[model samples]
Target chain A: MAKGYLNFVLHAHLPYVRHPESELYMEERWLFEAITETYIPLIKYFQKLVDEQIPFRITMNISAPLITMLTDDILQERSLKYLVERLWLAHKEIRRTKGHNDLNNLAKFYYYRFVEQYKIFKREYNCNLITAFKKFQDMGYLEIIACPATHGFLPLINITPNVSRAQIANGIKVYEEAFGRKPNGMWLSECAYIPELEDALNEFGIKYIFLETHGITNANPTPIYGTLAPIISPKGIVAFGRDLESSEQVWSSITGYPGHPNYREFYKDIGYEADWEYIKPFVAKSGHRVDTGLKYHRITGKTDFKDYYHPDWAKEIAEEQADHFMHSRINQINNSASKMVIPPIITSQYDAELYGHWWFEGPYWIYMLFKKIHYNQDTFELITPSEYLSKYPNIQVSEPAISTWGAHGYSEVWINPGNDYMYRHLHAAAERMVYLARCITKPTEIERKALNQCARELLLAQSSDWPFIVTMNTMVEYAHKRLKDHIGRFNALADMIDKHDINEEYLEDISYKDKIFPNIDYSIYAK
Target chain B: MQLLKSEYYELPAKYNQTVIRLLVQSPTRMFVYWEVSDETIKEFNKNNQNYSDCTAVLRVTNLTKNYSYNIPVSPFANNYYIDVEDSGCNYQVELGRISKKKFVNIYTSNIATVPSDHPASYDLSKDGVLFGNYLCIGNKKRLKIYGNKEQYSRFQNQNHTAFENRRNGSSENNFLGSSDNFIGSSGNSMCF
Candidate 1:
């Protein structure tokens, strides 16, 4: 019998960054990059695992906004075009670096990667990632979970209880419409949880939720298993806490596997290293420097000086790291197995983007890990949250405490003094949004359209990424503009409704710009 | 609960809205913004034909704790934004007219929670940051990673600056323009 279970969860989320007016918006590149790097690599690995008949279970949160972007026609077309351009660039790189031994090989590697992912995007899923994930769900290898609409930090958005309620409701609605079934679990925005959020989760029929470890261990009645077992809320919502030990083992930069000198360096890219004139057309439209993801160097001892990347060396390290990770988990499960009434479950999760985006070898590491575990592991079984719950129905009842997975383990990173200034605007807009949603009982077609547009603006405005960017001090200007623009749109739409002169031109302009939640009903917020 | 309408006010069709809102700025500050449309303002002026003392009364209620406070708004201020000092309470704002010391309630905003800086907003948490350390909060307790000694020492050498930054409390501690703690050189595991 397996001594313990290992549950791997990947949260795939990106703030809705669709700009219909301008093609090639800098922010929109986030989606395309994640698709080419993270999403495609992950899917390919999972597909190989399935082909090999390696029984595995993983819970993935395809966040509402990311799903919206993935399914977006314009974005799909843009992603394909983006991939072709990169492939074209890679072909050029191959010819330009023909004489140089290291650069030529690296160029070929990138070319094949881009080609494979683009083929997967077009040939396999028909340019719809939702279909691919749903197929996996239907096949019982993966559980596709919904992330809250717009990835709002629920603890703060719950201030207007109805806003959180609407978010939860809308998220599931989108997931169900896309996947043809309700989600089994949800990845909370920032893993920030307040006690009242469980009621919303339970009300929406979300069976379980994953939180930062403290979210479970800090439960009212302390859980016996700590982060090893799931805690049940009074309302029957199951809460899975992250295994801190396991998480740190993989995520700690100093000791993490990705930091191995052989791995590809995330910061060093051709976009910055290459001749600006040569890389201009391939970089962002502004002709400014941006990561083209064509990294030619390894981490190489953490210096400004870099060494030419060795693919064979990186592949060797990836396999070793994967083996090392599996052994670490086995050791952990064995260590905890003796004390638990039921077999322990070690749950580990990370940002899906971290795999192929920041840590380029991450997907390769994951593939090797799964492959190593499939034939060799006998001590642990990979299981999904739903699978674990099914096997162990009875759980310790406790209400989780308020917590987030931020640096200080609270809302300070997001709600600190620097970003606190916008809470008032967000909250006020949310309140007025609920009022607008509730008040419009009888409406003309235009009135309904305007109301729906207002709700869209509210949802877009509530995204936690804006505040996060401000606090993180990256793209602060863009973040501020996004927050202000969304709220500004919401308030302006409200004014139009008040004046009883719905500006068709203005409404159409905004409607075209913020094209998310196509079938949203304003009544979702009417409590 | 009926609103008093004046003859001069041309209220929009189905014009029943009192743009009153409450936003939690921090653990201690609640920001309020409310606006009365032109039609409503015109109606209010027309109703006060004699122009007796007409003041806007802002009444705030903390529904979570069942506490309430009534603050007077400046009559001339059509657009008002005020900051109330409080936290950890679910609040609602009501705008009313005060004439001859009799209040007539006009608009009530939706309830919004004044977010607490005290992250211990849980029944299970006895005090401090968490619910009793069952799920365990805080990144302070990092388990010693069992890895190759060679890799560990190499990593330690590279991260010496991070440790130095932490000791000095310079860029890492500063929230302003400090991407050091957020992006590069920091290993804060994103808990999203």
Candidate 2:
């Protein structure tokens, strides 16, 4: 029998960013980049593990917006175009760096990676990642979960009970449509929770949720097992607190294993390194260089100079890090088991993009870690939250302190000054959504489409990424425009509903653009 | 959609007199955002209610179990620091006008529970429009130096020193965002 359990959850979320109007919407690259660099790599990795008949259980949140993007034909085709351009660029790079052995190897790495991603994207999965993830779930190797309609920061947008309720309700609709089953758990956007959120989760029949460390440590009465045990709320929904030690080991960019000098440097791509004229065709229309995922340098040290990255060295380190991580977890679980009456379960969750997108070696680390834990461990077993909860259902009943994995461990990241002004607008829009949801006394088919589209607008605007991006100010104009445009659309639709003016042409235009949840009911927002 | 347990979300008292709503901001704070409507203000005016005499009396009632409270606010505070001891206890709040020392129910909020920490911890919740500018890896600074010069300059000019402060682990006025805070941000207020 296993002495303890370790639960790994990867949250895969990207804000809904689709531009049916533009052929080269620059910001849409976030989705394209993630698809090529993050999502496909993970699918390929998991496919290998499954083919070998390895038994593994992990939870993933296939957030609503990501599902919509993965299923859209335009994005699918655009991503394929993006991949083809990458392939052309990689082939050119093979000759460009023919003499430089290290750079040539790096170029070849990207070339084959793109080639394989193209195959997996087009043939294996047929360009729909959601279906692939759904297949994994159907096969019982993966536990797919849900998230808010557009990953709205619930504590802020949930001003009205109905507003939050609608976010949850619509999210469920999209999840069931994509995954073919009701979600048993969900990723609270930003992991931001208020004390009363359990109320909403229970109402939605969600069984479990997670919080950052303080969320568990700060429990009314300090938890006996700290983050090692899940806390069931006074309501039945379970709350898993993130393991700080494990989260920190992987989260630190400068000090984490990914920053080791042997690992490929995340920033040193060939796009910027090569001659401007030579790479112009591969560059954006604006002549700005984009990351080609063809980095040749290693994160040597604090200095500006870097070394040529050795994939052989990086894989060795990844293997060592995987073993190191598994042993540390084994030790932690064993230590906790010796003192605790029940088996201690440590939950390690991270943004799924971190694996292959940012770290590059992250997928290898995960692949190796699963192997090391399976073959090299007797103290701890890899488990899912559902498995742990069922094995030990009688848990301490208390309110897991309200928290999020965001900046300040609270709602400040979403409600701060730079972004706070948006709230009054957001809150009012939510109020209007609830009002229109209930007030549309009777509606024809056209009016009903307008109302449902209005619900989509409000839900899309409420995505936490917009405020997060606004606060980050990385793509300020884009984030700002997305929030305003959605609010503008919602307001226009609400006004039409109030004035009894239904414009089918306008409705069809937005429906074609912000087309996510077609069958969603506006009545979900009814208070 | 199957009806949510009517009791789970059903409002306790139908509040129509005032546009008053309560939010449990944190563990120890349950505050209401209220705008006494024209009718409410007019009614108060007709009844000879003065600003000094109108106190926002918050009433907390346990909807699930049997428990309640009537706490008086000091004349003009929209925020209430609640002391309801039960964690995850189901409760609702109502704000009223204490006219001539008599409690007058003006508005009530949807069912909510007190947060898990003192509301004072949220002093920084509105500290500033904190721009969180860091992700787990490949920040703008490196992106800039690595020769994505165009986008780098654009992102650099757009963000502030807060992101820099965050990465340095300074915990300065930046109020927190990513990297160090991603792993953990130590605070004196949490239960630990």
> What i-RMS does each candidate reach, in Å?
18.2, 20.6
Error of 1 at A381 (Å): 0.5
- On the 0 to 100 scale, the lDDT of residue B23 in model 2 is 51
Stretches of candidate 2 exceeding 4 Å from the true structure: A285-287, B1-114, B117-192
Q: Model 1's DockQ? A: 0.03
Once superposed on the true structure, which residue ranges of model 1 sit more than 4 Å away at CA? B1-192
Cα lDDT tens digits for candidate 1, A1-527: 88899899888999898876665468888998999889999899989999999887888998889988999998998888888889998999999999999999999999998889888999999899889988888999998899888999887667674889878888888888899998878888988777778667767877778888877766654665789988765445678999998798778988987788998988888888789889998888866788887999999995889998988899999998888889999999888887665678888989899898888889888888888877878999889987877675545545676668887667766766567666667777777877877788888999999999998888898898998999999889778888877887888888899788999878887887788888888888777
- Model 2 CA lDDT for position A166: 78
- lDDT tens string, model 1, B1-192? 122221121112222444665544444555555666666666666755322367778888878888777788787653344455665567788887875677766678777655454433332222111011111111221112211223224434754211111122333233222222221123321110
Clashes of 2: 7
lDDT of 2 by residue, A262-372 (tens): 887888887788888887777565568887666788888787999998889999999999988998898898777876656898899999998888888898888888877
Best by DockQ: 2
Residue A111 displacement (Å), model 2: 0.9
Q: Point out the worst 10-residue segment of candidate 1 chain A by lDDT.
A: A392-401
